[model samples]
Target: MKIRISKATIVDERHPDNGKKRDILIENGKITKIAASIKTEVDKVIESEGLCVSIGWMDMRANFRDPGDEQKEDLESGLKAAANGGFTAVALMPSTNPPIDNKGAVEYLLNRAKSGKVQVVPIGTISKKRAGESLAEMYDMYRAGAKAFSDDKESISESGLLHRALLYTKNFDATVIHFPYDATLIPNGQINEGVQSTLLGLKGIPAIAEEMMVARDLTLLEYTNGRLHLGPVSSAMSIKRIASAKKDGLRITCETTAAHIAYSENELENFDTNFKVLPPLRSEQNRKELIKLLKSGKIDVISSDHSPEDEEHKKLEFDYANFGMASIESFFPVLYTAVGSSMDLAKLVATFSINPRRILDLEIPEIKEGVRANLTLFSISEKTVFEKMNLKTKGYNVAEIGKELNGKVLAIFS
Candidate 1:
């Protein structure tokens, strides 16, 4: 029997189903029927009140600690969490234990993440072992199925090394990602450098650290004429910088996380480590500006930056705690609630769906008959509270623990 979904509103602007409510019958993982009514018995039925469906969503930045650090998350559990969060595809970060650097590592990840309802795209390291030294075999990893390359959480400090990586990857049209962090400037930085850090008496990472690195990369992109994606940016100034760079005709793109868009430095007043992320959360003004920037399309995609840190690293004292938030499971609801009214619902949803795949140069799903059953059943008006029972990630970040969310993801069919 086929899976039948009746009266589910379609929201993908790319297809004829953009604003239609129809009965969709899926058989053998393909949509066989789409009409106002269908008289057919099916093995599975997904017809709920006010439900909406769109192309399967994607998260371009997420980590599944396989090959090592499985305690944080393995491939299967990570996919379960992603499916629960409405993502049908995710780009796995190369920051794992052995690290995804060479062609072998990329093959291993692709094999390990073979199935389970989500496509796992690996991001190869810019340097071998992510040591910021000699460049890794970019062409080899690309041949092994890496869509992009990055050093993840560590910026390439040496201009010569970064310059070489950018100039080299341009040969095959591969995109290079950079995390903007100046190690010397913010040596002991713990949180965003502002009134909150001063009042809390904790170390701070100034916005300039992020801006400076972003500026450097933009300059290099102008020089090398390379394709670059600056990610997890959290400052207002950096957004403006990238927008200006884009206007200047440099091949550049950027992304910001849902956590940075939802929470500001105020959340760190309690010294909660879950709020501690690299390119640390900034002031309220920056948060508001981030939403506005996202609405204006300055930020190309909204990623979960779904970094998962285990209890041993997260449950430590404020100063001793590791930096991260296990956030893929909370990306949709948390993001919808924070900017549901501010940003266009269709555009915001696209940020998590088509935009990510487009940036990675992958095929985007369309919600029409005769297509594969790649979709996320969701609702924007539904209210949700993420409690212990609902938190699917191995690590829980406090920002979304008790927050009231404005969206609900029913299921994903692929």
Candidate 2:
């Protein structure tokens, strides 16, 4: 098959044509030519006003409840949602029924994802069955193509366990991803601990829960000299600490979700269950701080945190609802709308594509001649509403429904 992307601004900083409007031609999935004009015959033409093309975007974190919970989301449906969201690759969180803690489970996801357009990089659990009592076979899972190790939403509460995991993975230069939260500090917590929670009478999760754990993880990373990735960080204090650690030259990286950037604890005022999330959205002040830090390059990635739940689990009372929303299908549009003007286009491309690949030790694709085309095409000028009609995932727990977003994904070639 042949495809032509006409007059789109190339957003890859590694390429010579960076920021230049050019026509890109692809034949048999390889980039054949790129120039000022290409009027040759093609099977398809992709063009739009204010169009931007970059090496395929990647989400560093997402949950596709496959293997045991296909009722919520299987590999096939999850990859379709990822492709629609303008991501050619996504790192799968190991938060399934059994959890991906062994080589067999890792291989299962890889083999299943082989048939899809969006590539899946499986993350194995840091503990056996995500129990946090003992370590899983990290070396064996890594050998089976598990790019990283994490307990995914289940924070490694035991200091000794997390320390050992970090130390063990360093032998192969592997990254240990952790969700920073001290579970003990936020028992029965429902939302951010603030005025919103007080008015709604929901038990609030204090910011110290996240801040304390981030401090502990940074300390462990420094002691063990192992690479670490802290994600879905929500508090301003955590950001301050992480920035200090970065300046001290620790082998650390971090991420925040698009939902955290776009919404805050105020969204929970109406008792909407969809706004419920782990590291539950903090104050409006923290939200603004997250956006500011992202523009300054303090945050390394922006993931969807695309957890999916069936209606039975999501359509419950606020306190009973699961802590997630189906977000992979609307990831790009929501993020673009949130920070498109304040951030440089090149910086946006880096966060979604280049940085995540580097952190996970994956191959970073480029927009050059003779290279295979792994690309995402989008338009900042296009308007889109992320309602059920456009949702590709089986999970229907999205909060952005009926909201007009600023950007739209045009196509993905992978």
Candidate 3:
């Protein structure tokens, strides 16, 4: 398979051709040559104005709902959505019906995703069956190819359990990913706690719910000297805490979602179920703070948090609806539309391509000759519409439909 990418500006900072427009040639899945111009015959040629190339993007957190709730999203559909979203790899959350807490489950996901262009890295459960009562087989699952350990969207309320898990994973140099929220504080809450919830007569989830857990986790990480990744964080205070922890030299990393940075609680004014998400969209002030911190590199990665729910679970009253959005296909477009003008292209590429892989201890691909062609091609000037037809996931819960976004993913090579 031969392909030529003409007049594309390289966005990888590690490459000498960074920010320079050049022709790239790939033969048999490896980069063969790069020059100012190449007049060569190939199986396909890709050329476009404002075309940009980077190391393949990776999503650190996402829910595919495979092996149990395939009706919502299967491995094939999820990988297709990831490829369309400019991600060559995604970390699957262990939140399925039969949770991925064992060696067999981790092996199953790896085997199923082996033939796909988009890689699937399974995240094993932190607790047995995601029950939060006992620790899962961390070492065994890690040996079976699980990249990290997490109980997705399920907060660990017991301090002793989290402490034990952190200490246990340290022996193998594994990272423990935790969603920062205290469920007990907002068991019935529907949206961010503020004027919107008051005006709509719905229960509200206060920012303290997230901040308190983040503080607890940071303390645990500091005491145990273990690597910890916290994310899909929404509160401004939580970000301040994580930033301070980093200054104190704790082994901590965090992430925020595209939806969190792009939309606020204002989207819930109309009772749209698609706008309902966990760590619900915060106030406009918090959204701006998130963007500022992300630009300053306080945040390490940006994930889609692509949770897919079937219509039966989504098309209900706001109070009863599920908390998620099928957002993988719209990930890069939403971020590009919301923050492209104010962000540096190289820094944005690092968040998606370099930082996430480093956090997970995975191999980071380079955009140089003699390397395998794991890359994403995109155009910042191209405009795309987010509509139902563009979605590849089985769930149709995206809230950005009908809006025009600034970027388009041209193709993926893996």
TM-score of each: 0.97, 0.98, 0.98
lDDT of 3 by residue, 200-279 (tens): 99999999999999999998899999999999799878888999998999989899899998999999899998999998
Candidates' C-alpha lDDT:
0.88, 0.91, 0.91
Worst 10 residues of 1 by lDDT: 390-399
lDDT by residue for model 1 over 1-414, one digit each (tens)? 588887888888676667788888999899998888888989988877778888899999998888698888888888888998889999999998898999999999888778578999999999999999899999999999999999999889999999999999999998999998797996978998899999999988999988999999999999999999998899888989999999999888899999988889999888888898887999999999999999998988889988888878888889888888899988888788789866666778888899889888899888777888899998876877888577677775545787778889988987
**Which pairs in model 2 have colliding backbones?**
none
For model 1 the TM-score comes to 0.97
Clashing pairs in 3: none
TM-score of predicted model 3? 0.98
Candidate 1: segments with Cα more than 4 A from true spot: 396-398
What is the alpha-carbon lDDT of model 3 when measured against the actual structure? 0.91
Alpha carbon lDDT at 86, candidate 3? 91
Better of 1 and 2 by TM-score: 2
Model 2: runs farther than 4 Å from truth?
none
